[model samples]
Target chain A: MENNINDDNAPKTCEYDPNVNQDELIKAQEKQIAEEIKANTAMVGSLDGLSSLEEEYSNDPVYSSKVKTLLPKFSNVRRTRPDGNCFLRGFIFAYLEYCIHHRDELVRFKKYLESSKEELFEIGFPKFTTEDFHDMFMEVVSDLEGSGSIDRVEAVCNDAGTSDYLVVYLRLLISAHLQKNAEFFSFFIEGGRTVEEFCKQEVEPMYRECDHLHIVALTAAVGVGVRVMYLDRGEGDALVSHDFPEDKEPIIHLLYRPGHYDILYKA
Target chain B: MPMFTKLAHKTSTAAKSSGQTAAKTAAAAAAAKGNVTSPAGKHFLDNTRWQKRLQKELMSLLKEPPPGVTVDVDQAHTKLTEWVVHMEGAAGTLYEGEKFQLQFKFSPKYPFDSPEVIFVGENIPIHPHIYSNGHICLSILTEDWSPALSVQAICLSIISMLSSCKEKKRPPDNSYYVKTCSANPKKTKWWYHDDTV
Candidate 1:
């Protein structure tokens, strides 16, 4: 039997006249854009059962060794769509899942969000638009009171309107955190751009990828620690781990590979 | 290659079909109610969220009209997608005394998508950036539109665009472009070459 699974079998590129093939080029570009939109809109898989991490890493020794280390700790990996908001989505799912089990924590989180709405308004978010997003966020969280299951949570996250609302609400929260604690965060900013400018340009915009600063602000805002396990090609037999809110124990575990993020679960 | 060809064909056909539907809807509305029908297609109106958002925005605009701008739906409350904005030219500008009615056509995406805005009434502004066909070449109305932007912001931008005009004259390629341009300006790939206008 031949091992053709990882073979490079793409068709060779053909040379074409730019002037004559202008329409064709545009058609190709449009198709690519359509495909990208389709990919982004596709339903994300939640709480994927990865019974054995060894199967995924069997081809690479470094990754296999790293998996072996994690095998004792975790059993399943929740896969989010590789859309730009993956980190935020993963965080929401993992945090909500935690909330489902911890009722007191859920109540506390809800109360925090309720009180934070006024803070968000004070931070300069328009009340009308902000209220819509805040209402949706409240609705989703409030629905998780008694009958919350992994399946129900997955359904909510997969729905585009609700998911986008949650993501935007998270972004607003992060922005508010940065704005509120400008003195501490100003040092983390690279350029001379003030915290407000940075928040407007980077944090507030939809689909803006979360950086370290965003992660820090989000964790601080929600008061929930996140543990991100880096899975990369970097020379490491050991999987790298970083905890947000440095001293606190992380409730959510995320697997980070370059630009993408997905939730991880302990056995 | 075949897939690409099919996709291109489908898109063009869809555009043509939508255009015909729009024409028919306009005719029907004129005959029945003497009001302008929504420019948004059936697919756009089908989304409940889009419809609700448009209504909310419409209410907000009506409650608090922006300075020098009066906004109202083109049709009755039933048609929420199309809006007619009457803008009084800001003081100290070339168009100070002039009044222009802007036709705003909102898609289902509402805030997510930029509204198709053009001057509809008589006496279109003779600015260098404003085409004779009522299509105003503005960046914020096109590529620079963000979901964060509201109808109020759009009105402000248009006011600013008109305010900054030094001379009242048609664009350089006004005649040729107007003759060859599509009915919908959104379809036209506008190259924003000049910021000075």
Candidate 2:
């Protein structure tokens, strides 16, 4: 949908040209390298701060053990690395640590995450990940904000034949994880907040349609840090629940009802 | 267990002695009689490599039991392979004292895909979402499924499904449940859009 642009942003008007010359290819590679360096630097603070975050959770010995034990296995499932340098793994663990220390915020975020699992899963998992995913996630967020894609996602989930909850989960997770990027966060917010509002308004209406849906957000400094949600289509309203384990806060539970989707303190 | 071996030996010997047509007929007969391990069943059973792989994996699952569950193979039926399983939920929930039976039918592409699980027995409370046939509408058994997921994982998911139910209601229509479920068994196309508040 983008119009033809000059050399700065566009692909340099290659209508007549079939092949990319050496210089252009080199420039593309350089741009890629620059982006990688930026991502690496942003992740640097998380890599160094992981130990302290782990220690903070150690204060609650039992919960700490549970988190420590479960986090690694979850990370292993989420890991896509053959050479051990995995962004999802490190990112999830860092987030979990954030949740452990900042109990109140963690609880609130966790509630939102749990309630939004079906939406998050579609946005954050299986289909989307790595480089291909980063772009797609940003695009969806932008589309939702600029083009009412948020309302559309919700409508799709609610309408006949559309995989509404799953789509919503995808958008929500993409939004939540993009916390690392302020612009992306804002874009995701426009989409995610709209979807959440729709859930509270339209989706919650028919009780029978809402059963068996649960949303859980999984946060580990390892693995594909995402919100996984399971929706049972066999029953009433889809019952949703989520799990949020972050670095700076104690995990919170976001429980939604007909009128309320609040973050319950889950220490 | 010994009968199982005898069936295998007998089937192989029959395969050697009989013509291809006879062998096929015998296998079909055994399967019709529900003697799945019988020589007749062997000839009629799916002979593809994928079927063998599925059988091996399903057997391993039968041998190792997960928590709060017991799986029993029905010795009576030979044509259809049936497992009658019972699961007890973790304490302090609606399902705590419940005992549910699940039936598994592994089609030709199982293990490489997923087996069909149906609820049997009076263990599960009838809910509007759950068909009387016990087929669930969960994603893991459908499009989101991967070969890495094992039979045990499916069983656990079912158990989890039982434990999560806050309400007890069967599908609004009882007659349609039995007749309508055979087609599109996974209900893969059905999307779960909303959750109970």
Candidate 3:
């Protein structure tokens, strides 16, 4: 008794024969899907009025009702590519956008970043590789100091290499933080993997999606909190919002729809 | 060469203003010295960060390479992007007394992306996870690649992979895979079946 067996949207598993040969075909299919997405979207998209979200869900009573509740609070949305790095990309875009308007926060963040590279090096991260990414962040920060414009931030965030490098350094910093406090993080690490293994497999690699641990570690590492508004098919009239690190107020707001994340601007 | 060029297009060039104005000249120099990165591939060479990373890796490898591994220095200097690595089977491994050459092709996205590595010489190993076409099914070479891991680390991993092998035979579907696989082994989403080797 499977529901909608022939439905295109049905949950598709790669368990079709568990065939090793089919991997190439799967890769090709994934490439095609990624290319289609690339052609249709931007890495970091421009803002859209909250009404756009409401219109998208107008046909669905539950989602529409839930979206209606959000419209009063969140004024606009900025989308990022649904690439697995969406969480970090959306987080950085929203956070940087906030920092642009608030210069003191930007300076404080820059100061923190200035010391973080040495910290990462001391933690045994290869200086040769890590330095380039650290320098890129510095370049962007100093560039923002000069320009102080949203267009500059948007362009940097949208540039594939620059944006991806920012995510990489953030990932490294998160990995370093989690490893430094492995005693506390060990309890949360799933699959019995040690902190280092988890960091290598999950946190250090590009294109791997972030999890609860990632968000927790990142928020703690950067000392910037994020508020993720969860939107889903759950039985609720309004979206549930949770702030990372629970105690600190979340300055960065994001809309989390299952696996993907996008920026949210409050009115 | 097609393999290198196809992936080269994805390398990072956004931050090339970092004093690598000599990239085109260097690329031309490389082409004259028999490097596979054609002068046509100069844009791939213009990535300063990528070049710096590769040059550093090359210097370190030449200074003190891992056991049983040696980089073709002249070839690497000719083109920092493509390199030839010589390997001798470890003293006690099943592959003892045999030799292999691996080609390491770096894209402009080095460190961020894994280098494309494959056995390039005639003596492609007859190992359960290795194909006749010289593609080795190692996870670290693909999805498991991390910027933290360097070229030396990959060589060490491959060395360890060979040292731990208990048998000498091609993968079960070696022929079928070699026939249908794309020119670039990186294009295949490899499903590592057995880790025990």
Tell me which of candidates 1 and 3 scores higher on TM-score: 3
Query: Whose DockQ is higher: candidate 1's or candidate 3's?
Result: 3
User: Candidate 3 on B1-197: residue-level lDDT in tens?
Assistant: 00000111111222331112122112212222322332213322234656777888888899879999999999998988899999999998999999999999987767666889999988998887678888878767776677667888889888888888888877777777787677788876565443455
Docking class of 3: incorrect
lDDT of each: 0.70, 0.38, 0.76
Per-residue CA lDDT of candidate 3, range A106-219, in tens? 999999999999999988887767887898889888878777688877877766556767888999999999999999999998876789878987888777778889999999
Give the Å shift of residue B97 in candidate 1: 2.7
True contacts kept of 2: 0.00
Per-candidate TM-scores read: 0.73, 0.32, 0.81
TM-score between model 1 and native: 0.73
Writing each residue's lDDT as its tens digit, candidate 1 over A1-267 gives: 675664467654764443343333333454354345435433346455655457877898877778777777888987776545778989998899899999999999999999999999898776777787788788878888856777767767666556666887899899999999999999999767689768865776555568899999999889999999998877767888999989889999998888888789998
Error at B57, model 3, angstroms: 2.6
Alpha-carbon error at B108 in model 1, in Å?
A: 2.6
Q: List model 2 lDDT by residue over B1-197, tens digit each.
A: 00000000011132222222222222222222332342212322334533444455456566776778776645313423455667777577666766777767665434333566667677654554466666565545643343334567677766666666677766444454445333335432233333431
Q: What's the C-alpha lDDT at position A85 in model 1?
A: 71
Query: Which of the numbered candidates is closest to the native, going by highest DockQ?
Result: 3
